[model samples]
Target: MKKLLIGTAALAMVAGAAFAESHSVVRLGTEGAYPPYNFINDAGEVDGFERVLGDELCARAEMTCEWVTNDWDSIIPNLVSGNYDAIIAAMSITPEREEVVAFTQNYTPPSPSAFVAMGDVDLSGSVIAAQTGTIQAAHVTGMDGATLLEYPTPDETVAAMRAGEADAVLSDKDYLLPVVEGSSGEIMFIGDDVPLGGGIGMAFRKSDPEMRAKFDAAIQSMKDDGTLNEMIAEYLGEDSPAF
Candidate 1:
């Protein structure tokens, strides 16, 4: 859901020609690990909410596209390096990320973040696990008494909590709710939901305003026609907020 380090200037240099070529087939980058938003299916293909939404957006914009999976840690850098034309992962629109890449309007509204643990425990001064390079991780790091534990993937964060490496795991409430429910009382959510970032949006190279504009328009069209909200419900559940 975020990034840590990237060479913004290098990304801009590499994006120049790609952004200028309007008719080229766009390559969409994603971390095929975040379920509901995206994940690798048993068939070894990217599949989930973003996959469906992205395909629709591409069709609406009249752009041919393909999916490319990359680790969350290097997703942004790869986009800048011309490895992909855009990032359709469930990336939150944050100021820190905006400095390195441009973002389209949010498709999903800002969802609440929550903490999950095996039992009731005080969050203050406790060790917490969060996916590395995410807003949740940054938020936990700055908490007055919390010691943040970072993991490369969301699954690892949950594993850390189960193994007692952390007192709790913090992440999007939507993402955690199903896991908590499926755990059959082994894991439960504690603490109030916290809102972070500006919702989820697609990321583009800073030089790719044209491509960004194409997608922004396509996204707005979906919202106007109720297609976007429908897709959100299909993947994130009926209660999921729309644009």
Candidate 2:
């Protein structure tokens, strides 16, 4: 979902606040609702894998950073419009996105997308829920005999499936694993995994190559020292592909 927490008003407070004007603080933008990737903790603070990874990267880069949350759909445009600095959400590096913003080297490898449904659902002609503006939604649009139901958030896609509005929900396998395990046998994988995107990478405005380069070097440093792989396993799962 590249999705989040923090209200629109909070987002507006940072809109058009250029990070380029100050090297002291780098604002890291994320959809703070996606757990194991990024989410809001009980204390109402940003938490999860991206949070840990982003903080470490900032430390390595010797940059002071603050987290900002924004909705998934307008994330790119907001970055361009200077809502925040880097997008450290689970945004996959893709050609389409590259047209709008530059990317740091990937932090996570390509992971499979999967379908989850309530029992024995056949996907051939089923209605599938996917977050709007995601690769899963785009995939469903071209899938033979499948109907796409777009939701604004990842949680809503699952809600749609649970409410019988959609037969299945499609999203990153890592993201869906916890939901399935917690469903008390109500949900299960319904089909083969679908692999998409290059990998998850931090996004920056194209005009900020220097910023991109800074994070890229930090990511590469992590990869070299195996810290990135350690983080991938701890949060995404031991089976998650490593750097």
Candidate 3:
């Protein structure tokens, strides 16, 4: 009985001591324009839900994270070319993307990606706006019923739609969640397919199994500890985007 108790105590110690491996510096690339998910501040600091989550993941993994802000269009390519180690921006995992890079298992799942169209406006037969080079943009443009007007970013697309220069905008659900709730105006989810695959992930060049493992452990730790959802709530508001 004493031997068993000692063994149990040893196992408990091992479990308690279990922790994610740390990297010296995990370079995190963010769009720094997608509000609530990731964005830049007046101070030029990258700050948002993704930013908060990155910090937490670093803490959990015991790594130092270097924040890199750049345009959304270039983020994934930069990752593949080793310009940055990982991406924490509001990027979803899709089959096409999987061809170029690997993603950490999804940490936060979001509502389906779709367009928020005005109720009274006839949105059909009109050009839909979305950020250029985004998965949202591709989805909208490729849809059988859609005619797409591409913009540079989510903010620009929203502006064009609000100005009636475009019919509606396609985006991730959480990114538009704030605008929809804040406005008293009516908005509707237009299509059957939201978006396929799963939630946003930390992307890395394929074959970097070591780096992937580090991030996987880090993200899983955050999810298990509730750090991930807490950051999302703080930035994107209380409606959680758990894809």
**1 or 3, greater by TM-score:** 1
Q: How badly does each model clash, as a count of residue pairs?
A: 0, 4, 5
Q: Which stretches of candidate 2 lie over 4 Å from their true place?
A: 1-22
lDDT of each: 0.85, 0.84, 0.68
Q: Model 1: per-residue lDDT, tens digit, 80-157? A: 778889999889898877777899999998888889999988899899999988888988988889999999999999
Per-residue lDDT of 1-243 in model 2, one digit per residue for the tens? 322222343233323443463486898999897888999999999999999999999999889989999888777777878878899989988776765677898999988899999988778899999988888888888898999998888899999989999999999999999999999999999879898888899988777777778889999999999999999999999998887
Ranking by TM-score: 1, 2, 3
Error of 3 at 144 (Å): 3.1
Of the pair 2 and 3, which is ahead by TM-score? 2
Q: Highest lDDT, which number?
A: 1
User: TM-score: which candidate is best?
Assistant: 1
Per-residue alpha-carbon lDDT of candidate 3 for residues 64-126, written as tens digits (9 for 90 to 100): 889988776666656655667787877777666666667888767745666777754444566
Per-residue lDDT value at 96 in model 2? 68
Candidate with the larger lDDT of 2 and 3: 2
Report residue 85 deviation for candidate 2 (angstroms). Answer: 0.6
lDDT preference between candidates 1 and 3, better one: 1
